[model samples]
Target chain A: MLEVKDLRAGFEGSEIIKGISLSIKAGEVHAIMGPNGSGKSTLAKVLAGHPSYEVTGGEVIYNGENLLEIEPEQRALKGIFMGFQYPVEIPGVNNAEFLRMAYNARQINEGKEELDPLDFDDILTEKMKMLSMEKKYRERNLNDGFSGGEKKKNEILQMAILQPKLAVLDETDSGLDIDALRVVSDGVNKIKSADNALILITHYQRLLEYIQPDYVHVLSQGIIVKSGEKDLALELEAQGYDWLTPTN
Target chain B: MTTTLVDASDQAESALLNLHKKFMSGNRPPEALVPLNEAAIQRFELLKFPHRKHEMYTFVNTKELVSTVFNLPGETVVSKDFIKSHVYPECESSYLVVVDGILNEDLSDNSAIQSSINLVPLKDAVDQPEIKEYLADTIEKENDVFSAINTAFISQGTLIDVAAKKQVEAPLQILHVSTGSASGNVTSHPRILVRLGELAEFKMIVKYVGVQGNYFVNSVMDILVGEQAGVTFSQVQEDATDAWHYSKTRVQQGRNSRVKAVNAFFGNKITRHHFEAHLKDVGAELLLNSVSILNDAEQVHHFVRIHHEAPHTNSTQNFKNIVNDKSRSSVDGTVIVNQGAQQIFSDQLINNLMLSDNAHADNKPNLMIFADDVKCTHGATVGQLDENQLFYLKTRGLSEKVAKELLTKSFAESIVQTIDFPGVVDYLENTLLKKLEA
Candidate 1:
């Protein structure tokens, strides 16, 4: 469903994701783990069509289309979703209303009837119930004053509502407590389907224990150095990325 | 060439003075307001029209307003349908309609709230003691030429008085509509005085609307809150595109009294609003919020001053401006804590969102604290929408235009949500959305 060929992207004049290539098929889950400043988030942002990053050299094809040519909003409408590591806090936009807008946008894109507030409320309520999110999240401003764990849960809630085909979860497990982590993982697992794919970007293997990935790729210095099964995560957890570092 | 310009400016200045003289010549004020009118005219003469060199009018350019020749407004008869369409649905039977600065008793119906509150035209209430004591007394007339001019022609206005220990559930609506004369441009001076007794609670929504043609509406409103009284005042200024609006609102709070004033400006070619809230007694609280959405060549200026005169007083001022195209908006807000007013808390914030490169916003949030152990903070921000915020909304599948409009509406919602009245919020939201779309 997704293919990245020699993705070379960065901000300004500095290169971050240099000469990285990866591919994922339908229903496949991939884990991209790297050390700090290893361009893990940069790759996610590049795929999400972030405006700040310049793709100097790369080709990303999603669903037989050049995904890089699509606008950020068009990407989302075309079933591309990026779970931001730090979701922006919009102080006055109600969370429920924002979710409804996103849902309706996707509905319109797919030639479906738009849902009004009352109709959308039922869908939103069911999604929140499935995720075990508090009702207060519906009325509060979008991510304003939300705790770190709550923000991550909200992201997962968005993923559940939109039901995106390709979701890049960037640092989704970084700020969650044990209970919240379990709840978020359960939400992702419930939303997972045979036709959808997930890319979990993380620095630790704790989240892997809940939703195991089909493939694990180790990224260092803007390049993937190793690719293996789920056990590679355990080996990396035990020995750390130091052993993977090349001695020029 | 310079002499010709000076002559034109002098002719414009004298036009207003001549209009005042002609108005007083035909209609003599009541005996109780004779000296007040005389003193106001004298003050107007001494102060004259504001120039660019004036400190208070530095950011506000009055060249166009002062150069225009304006005649005293003639009688204006508006249809009942127009009044009904302009007023909020909740205030159907509890409204006062003022046309061309004169209260239209035939069109106004306060029967729903007349039992709980006293609603009288200023012309008929001049003999009352409260009217004599508080009328035109709250505003500072030393430097405000508009206030002085409004006082000079304050015979026709509205006076509202709430008794002690009364909780008026119905919101009082004052609709000021300006209809220029058929002959030429006209000017109207509308005045309002509201007094709440001890422990009284009241809510008011003042709305301004105008018909086509160029006209000026100079309005003055004074509100006095008694001990433990609470008041919520919402002012919506939606004048015509060619109209000029100038208003001065002064509020005085008694011991333990609370007042919340929300001002929303959406129309008018040029608007100047002067607001002052005095915490005269201890424990008095004041909340002042203003939102101005302007586009094209529209200009709006706000001068706000909050005085913490007594100990333990608190106040918050939030002013937001959404300027688009070539429009310009300025806010000069100052909070002063007296020397002995300790334990006072105050904060002033000014947020301006410039939607276009040609748009401009000038904000000055000032703090003058003389008392120790007081908490006061003031900050101003002038910028376009946050790029990160915009990108976030766009990534949610919202189109770029929809995303920008939503973000703009959210910026003003922070202030709009603070308004507690029903129907007013919906009206403001619709107006804001229309402006954003435009």
Candidate 2:
């Protein structure tokens, strides 16, 4: 389970997400929808312990641990994953190698046995098959020269391999096509179990039709103003954020 | 073996005294010491040992290195098993051993050498009339001090010749090993001369390794490519860190010829390398690449010059350095194009990844041109790892140290990935991993 107590985070000196709070129980998917500059991505980044975004206030408690106090890598070892809106292009670094390292990082952190090269290949191949990723992606540099859809699917593939306790998807559906979206969504659904929680951050409600969130929350001006069941996502999709603003 | 810093007063001064006297009092220098033995010595007399004030020698001062002496080297013998264990582990290779700056004839391969290929040591190459003529005629006599010193006090080296249109199936491994003691501060000159005939293709791997001792090595190499010849050379410097090494490599490419070079520098207290490539004919192509990792108080400087003389030529040069501790590095590269060299496409980029705050890297990419119809660009960047990439990697479950190492390795992979040999590529990767972990 994950509980955020009045989280306030932002860049340099100014606060972007001010006094925001939320809670998500295990085995459930939570959707956070907001307009542009509403600080949805900021919240996800803060939870992932990005150094650029300073957490001036608030506490992020995840599975009984203060996530904010640890470094980004430590947070990652504790089962926190972020699927970026735009994946980085690390040329000359093989995708297979990076994925293996990521998997081993968590294994080592949990005091579990790590996988060797042969076993790593076997498991990674199975995971890649499920994601429908081309075998060539294994040898190519991470996200280097990759298309929008490939980058998105690769992100999903990483999430599948890490099998983290909590995953924060940050606009993962932005540049993906319908085929890529369906594949990524299916991969995410396959990994959802009783031991982990999913935080879906998106502006459009299209991805919700596949993952099916347990609760829908509307964020604006760095604050959560509304929360309800799945029906709220549909309502917001139909009416937009116009009605939420105060009138004269 | 560790090289302790002796005070400038007693032991250190005596070491310097012994090295200098032994150098000047030695018997008449060998004939192979220079392209023009007497003429080159005069040039050496005019130039002085390098000082820190020299822009190219800023990080590594040759004066401090040459002031000490080394034991004269003896016995140019290397066991076959040692070569197998150290240089080529994956496959069988034809080897050339140059011990103490002199060619070890018994250890070298002659029967396996191709019919079109002529392999001779400097002891014999100097006797050939044509060799003497071209050795000094192709390039200018040394204006720099260290080069003149190498010319004036040199002993021997290696000469490789590949006939026109001949291609060697196996890679050539050139091993320059240092052994023996000549007494107070020792010095030796090693030279490599390679000539590729028209339409020939070959790859050479040169290793400059030390036998155990605090020695100083000074070497110069001359390489020439004939019309349409293609060559790729890789230099791996894992010499003794306690020694001072100063080296130079000069190359010239003929019509339609192509050359690709890469240097892997991983050693020494003070090491300096200079590379110059002249594209003197039409349609010539050259690619220069290098990667160096320096730690402790070590300093490494690499200077390169690429001159384009004809139209329709292509040239690209890139050098990367990873410095830690208080080590320092510098890269100066120049790409010149003449007026007649229209349609020349050239690009030079020098990038450095500094691992510590005190470590420093100075990179300068210079360009001078007399032609307007050419594509030329040069840039340099020095900084730490990318923060975004670091964060993204760490968020994937890697520890901060692991993530940083991966990124740094990736930065170097840009150049190493271009190596055509898969085994060599993997070997370099593992070596870099160890360095990063350290």
Candidate 3:
């Protein structure tokens, strides 16, 4: 469903994702683990079409279309979802209203009828219930004054609502407690389907315990150093990224 | 030749004072208001139109207003449909329509609230003790030229008195409509006096609307809240593009009294509002919020002062401005805590969103605290929309324009939501969106 050929992207003039290649088919889950400043989050942002990052040399084809040419909003409508590592707090926009707007945007993209507030409330309630989110989530401002765990849960809740074909979860497990991690993992698992794919970006193998990954890729200094089955996560957790580092 | 030029210039600068003289000469004011009018005229004479160097008028340019000769507007006939179009449906039966600065009894209908409150025209109620005592008591006409001018010509105004401990269920609406004359530019002074007795509760919405032609609306409102009384006052200024609007509102709160004043400015070429709140007793609380959505060459300036004269008083002032095109907005707010007013809590914040490089916003938040152990804070921000916020919304599938509009509206929503009047929030939201889209 997605292919990245020699993806090299960076911010300003420095290269971060250097000559990386990856391909993911439908119904597959991939975990990319790396240490600090290892370009784990940069890859996710580049795929999401963040404007601050410039793609120097790369080609990303999603569903046989040049994904790089699409704008951020168009990318979302085209079924590319990026779970922000740090979701911004918009103090005045209501959470339920924002969710409805996103859902309706996708609906309109697919030539479907738009759901009004009352009609969309049912879908929101169901998705939130599945994610174990409280009713206050429906009324509070979008991520304003929300705890770190609540922000992660909100991202998963968005995933459940939008039902994107491919979701890039960046650092979703970084700030979550054990219980919040379990709940967030359960939400992702519940939404997983045979026609969609997932890319989990994390630094710890603890998240792999909750949601098993089909493939594990170790990233170091802007390049992929190792690719193996899920057991590679446990190996790295026992040791560290030092052995995987490439010597000059 | 130099003497002649100076004389001509001086004559031209005295255009407003000449207009004032013409008004007083042609009309005879009430007997009870003669001394007050005389005092106000003297004050206006001493302090004429404020110059650019004036402290309060630093950012405002009054060259055009000082040069233009505005005639006093006479009573004009207006259609019922016109009045009905501007009246809020919720206040249809309790609204007072003021046309050309005079209360239009035929067009106004206060039958629903006549029993709970005493509503009398200023000229007719001048003999009443409350009217005589509180008419110009709270406002400092000596220091403000506009307030002095408004007081000098306060023949057509309203005096509303609420009985002690009475709760006014219906929200009162004071609709000031300016219908400029075809002959020349006109000006009107609309005065409003509201006196709430002890423990009384009342809500009022004052709106300014103007029709075609060039006009000026100089308005003044003095609100006196007795001990433990609560009042909610909302003002919406939607004058014509060619109109000039100025207002001075003075509020005095007694012990444990509360006042919430919400103001929204959407129209007028040049608009200025002078707002002052005096917390005269302990436990008094004041919440002042204002939002200005300006475009084109429109200019709006707000000068606000909150006085914490008694201990334990609290106040908050939030001013937001959304300026686009070449428009400009300024907010000069100050909170003063007296020496003996200890333990007072005061906060002032000003936020400006500039959508164009040419747009200008001047914000100054000042605090003068003479007491010890008081919590006071002031801050000001002037910037464009947040790019991170924009990207976040855009990634959620909203187009850039929709995202910007939503964010701009959200900036004003915090203040608009505090208004409790029916259909007001919707009106303000729609108006703000329309202005943003334009």
> Which predicted model would earn the best DockQ?
1
Model 3 Cα shift for residue A64 (angstroms) = 3.8
TM-scores for all candidates? 0.93, 0.86, 0.91
Per-candidate total of colliding backbone pairs: 0, 10, 0
Q: A1-248 in candidate 3: lDDT tens per residue?
A: 89999999999999988988899989999999999999999999888888998999979999999898999999899887889899999877889999999999899999999999999999999988887899999998889889999998999998898898999999999899999999999999988889999999999999999999999999999989999999999999999999999554
DockQ for each of the predicted structures, in order?
A: 0.73, 0.62, 0.64
lDDT tens digits, residue span B330-360, model 2: 8878788987889999999888999999998
Chain A (alone) TM-scores for all candidate structures = 0.98, 0.97, 0.98
Better of 1 and 3 by DockQ: 1
Against the correct fold, how does model 3 do in TM-score? 0.91
Better of 1 and 3 by lDDT: 1
Ranking by TM-score: 1, 3, 2
Give the TM-score (0 to 1) of chain B in model 1: 0.95
Kindly indicate the candidate among 1 and 3 with the higher TM-score.
Answer: 1
lDDT agreement with native, every candidate:
0.88, 0.79, 0.87
How well does candidate 2 score on lDDT at residue B99? Answer: 74
* Predicted candidate 1 versus true structure: per-residue lDDT over A1-248, tens digit per residue: 99899999999889998888889997989999989888999999999888999999989999999999999999999998899999999987999999999999999999999999999999899989987899999999999999999999999999999999999999999999999999999999999889999999999999999989999999898889888999999999999998786334
Higher TM-score: candidate 2 or 3?
A: 3
As for lDDT, the candidate ahead, 1 or 2, is 1
